[model samples]
Target: MSDDLTTLHDDGVLEIPISLESAGNSLDGDSIRNGTDALHEVMRGHRKARAVLLVGKGKNFCAGGNVAHFGGADDRRQFLRGLAHDLNTFTDALYATQLPTAAAVSGWAAGAGMSLALHADFAVGEPGTRLRPAYPGIGLSPDGGMSWLLPRIVGLGRARTILMRDEVLNAQTALDLALLSELVDADQVYTRAREIAADLANGPTGAYAAIRRLLMTTYSNTLSEHVIAEADAIADLSITGEGVEGVNAFLAKRAPDFPSARN
Candidate 1:
């Protein structure tokens, strides 16, 4: 990996390797500014990336914010607040891309680390992987969208219990709760995530984006309102080259070659 640890593969998957054993990727500090910049490039459609793959390199996927830094700051309150703004900035850029995303989460995902993994549409982990809503343990509430994401993935009641109780969830439990989408062996986590992300990149990128939009907004819409949104999405999609190619491929009885229709 290079200084920024970001690479765009030939397959149209943007591979961002989180290294130094925990990405220590604070939403607050400068540690993740490079990633934020990369995501901004994607949002501008300059990267030509169809999907994103996040790989964790180390014994743990991420240990969250560097606790040492947390304590080192002289003005602790201002420092934390600044970090919050940075975290929000990074996450907002990632969300704006509307691309399919996956993560190779191989070991302990704690504190902001768990929140980061939750951003992925699919998180591939090992059987030994673990998740902990470690914010409270550090005398803080959740950041990095943890508060919003947990409830959506596991339900409000269950999410509440987990957060309030500061639970350390095992890999199997995390998978069962839909927190981790897939589980493989420890060594295969990154490979599996890349495979899945590449497959997504080759798919109908526009449709995947629409699905992400629908799912993210579903809770805010009632049945009647949601159906209208769904109709609008498909109607808009039908007029695109991707839609036409999909229909033609189906009629021709062959798999869709979406890349050929890429604009």
Candidate 2:
């Protein structure tokens, strides 16, 4: 992976840094491209990353898109279309990944940055961390699944209020609204996030993936259909090595050692 966008940690954590000190860590075209490419590489088995950690390099997490680029683009329409396309693709990949994901957020998470952080299964933020939709403020519509995710996360009315009013939510508010999984000290954000990711990585990956799939389709499925899906999922998983091991471990009164860990 390119150092500019991401770095793979030895503990199987893929770290994508959203901050660029020179540009105040704002999202840029290159960062979007590189970060997405890195995610694809990991998903395709080109790299070994059991979990992903989205973070910012400096004090601020991400300041959203580079507005300067928007003004400078000779073909503003084409530029914006391409940028949004790449960002949407990246966010899609993030949501589809089998690996559990986490984020260590600080300072500001605005626009696409907020979307990216929200995509993670678990996001840890400090007390000072702030989240904003930031689209209406700049006369733009939501992208990167913000429209879909926000409503699901905070309900339709609250999501509408947030987007329409450009409400900036602090870490506590975000946590209260279920946007953040945990709130920690500024210095402990990354450490706590990584610890959570590592714990997830060591657990039953297949089961985790199954749960993600089930939840992703929950709203779309009827209760009868959902129960059938759940039954099928459990039946399928029951025969897997991890599932067998887990069952056996339970019966034997011992800890389960998942097959993924052995590999």
Index of the highest-TM-score prediction: 1
Q: Going through the candidates in order, what is the number of backbone clashes in each? A: 3, 1
Q: Residues 146-214, candidate 2, lDDT per residue (tens digit)?
A: 999899989999999999999999999999999999899999998998898877766787798889889
Looking at model 1, the pairs that clash are: 27-86, 27-87, 28-83
Listed in order, each prediction's TM-score against the native is: 0.94, 0.93
List where candidate 2 sits over 4 angstroms from the true fold: 1-4, 259-263
lDDT of 1 by residue, 1-263 (tens): 23456888889998775445543433224446667788888888677888988766577777677778789999988988877777788778777888899998988888877988999999998989989988888888998899999999999999999999999999999999999998999889988999999999999999999999999998999999999999999999888888988999999999999988866
Off by over 4 Å in 1: 1-3, 22-31
lDDT of 1: 0.84
| Candidate 2 residue pairs in backbone clash | 20-25
Worst 10 residues of 1 by lDDT: 22-31
